[model samples]
Target: MIESGFAKNLTGQNLSSHLGPVSGKGDVRVGFFWTKVQLRTKNPALNGKIVNRLCIAKQPIGDRYTVSHAYISQQDAARLYPQEFGIFTQYETAPANGTPLSDIPGVSRSEIGLLELHAITCVEDLLSLHPDQVSQIGMAASRVYKVAKGWQDKKDENEEILTAADVQAKAEEAIKAMEERLARLEANNTRLQAENDVLRHSASGHPAQSAAVTTAVQAAAAPGDDAPYEFPDDDGFMAGGDVVTGNDDLSDMPDPMKD
Candidate 1:
């Protein structure tokens, strides 16, 4: 259960205490929360097996509120993991510019559903679905254009407001992914480089041995398998130099290497 008191973090004010739909025995409680909402109650069904200390959040209920004592959904708790904590899910912005049609400046809720039925879900959808099709739903082309333009402007404005931290975080993800890939490639490259070095070393003295090694190496590569890569880690191939990229096709090692 979430503890009671003054609020802090991403959610500054007391959480609105709306009586949510009670599902089942409230025993197997479940709901999908974008940012997990904590329940002030600690029903037995919600406790025991599916508990995580981090899922707890302060939320107002009835006259009073609880903080740290309330528990959130298990799925929500799991969702919050893998990323650094303290920064709650609420802080994250939408991945894309477009929002629900009702969120557009002049679009109303009732009209949103009607447009949704026509597959005109968001402003981005407007770009795909022609204005003529929207007009079929009795919506003016100018009005649709206005909402779409507003969403575009809003997206641009919000994009400009992105903090340096946001940019850095995105960069970090890209860099992390790149570093992991580069490390695998570097290792594969080193192995290939070592093999090439061995072939060169063998050629320096033992001409016959070098010839045998070359044949064995070529045989290990298999028929038509040029510059064999396919590292064991399931990483995609990295071509060029000793490190070859592209193609996930794995080939068998020759009988000589089987020993």
Candidate 2:
């Protein structure tokens, strides 16, 4: 199985180089926030290489915890110390903001992991992610691509908050413009509908006129009693006090007003 390792100094180191020597038990106190070294063996092939690196440490405190080379596996610590109070490498550290990527000694930028990059909590973490991976998590590809290219979010440095009166004025102007356009379209539609009704009334009278003309031409072309022209009743054709009659031999016909 894959295993993880971490190393911490049980005893605190001397701070003499930075400050003068203390008399008795020393002023520096061992604390939880002291530096820690960690190593991981995700696969078996890297186990021996990791173990050998941890066995050579002469001292386990001070600048030792600060260097990346001080991290080692449990197997090598057993071989080197073989006694009490040697390097006690464990499997994990308590959850906290990890060491910053910039402050991790001897580790290069390329060797950084997702967790390590997250510790930085900066644009560097965003840029390290692949574009496809970002897209898979439903983030915008262009935004991620811009981040990878070292782009920062746009900030309106000179922007000032608008007053309430300014916001109200802009809203009123927009509503007024929309209402005016709606009123103009309504007027145009009414005018077109009136014009269309007049045209339709005028067109209805032509069908009866065309039928009468056709009957007259037929009567003139025929000479014998064998030809008979049937005319429909004209009582249904009255409009605006005008009575329109169908075609007949009007030379001998009486006016309907006299009848």
Candidate 3:
């Protein structure tokens, strides 16, 4: 039974009376909380002393309001244990996130109630129950355990498949990025090589051309001793009177006759 009257924490505020009784028979949210309880002593020195106490807070199903008398005393908790087995389980073993017993496949209401009587409130609790404890639940304990185990196994397998797919996608993205980078690098290298070739051609072309021109000018200005000199006419013929042979002893040669 829940306490009726003002809660110990809030002065002159009747929380339990405002809200109806709280029980774990129905769906409710249960969580731990700290309550500030005011102490009243006969001695004047001990009067008005406030202390913090750890307790439970119960809210309606679907995350509704916090019901009255959310914080139940030890005596109230013990009395309500048979009705609110969840509270007793939370008080003793703090279970982690898990599927509710009612949600387990092939589990009936009577089986759930029986399991709760033994402080097994969730799927995790049932799966981890000792063989001895499971035997205590009756002949159908093994069947119920197998069903919960199957559900967990299937969930884990799905998670693994999703993880593998995610990993593969990331790897593909990384490979694509690396390939693009390599292509850019190759293009830059090719451009640099072309520029180098152009630079080499520009640097060597002028010097070679200038060298050929100098050689031709030197050959024309400084002829060999045996070289001949001649004057050409517009008809592509050498002028006969202007020809000078390399032999200096030409005094005996006959003079040209005027036409």
Best by TM-score: 3
Q: Arrange candidates by TM-score, highest first: which order?
A: 3, 1, 2
Residue 173's lDDT within candidate 2 is 62
lDDT of each model, Cα atoms only?
A: 0.55, 0.47, 0.67
Number of clashing pairs per prediction, in order: 18, 0, 0
TM-score against native, each model? 0.25, 0.20, 0.28
Per-residue lDDT of candidate 3, residues 152-191 (tens digit): 8897879978878767766666677678889999999999
lDDT of 2 by residue, 115-215 (tens): 33334233445456776765554433334345334422231222233345455655666677678889999999999999999988886769888778887
Candidate 3 Cα lDDT to native? 0.67
Candidate 3: minimum summed lDDT over ten consecutive residues — where? Answer: 250-259
lDDT of 1 at 73: 52
lDDT of 1 by residue, 121-195 (tens): 556776666666666677454476667776777777788566555666566666776788899999999999999
Measured by TM-score, how close is model 2 to the native structure?
0.20
Best by lDDT: 3
Worst 10 residues of 2 by lDDT: 25-34
- The candidate, 1 or 3, that scores higher on lDDT is 3
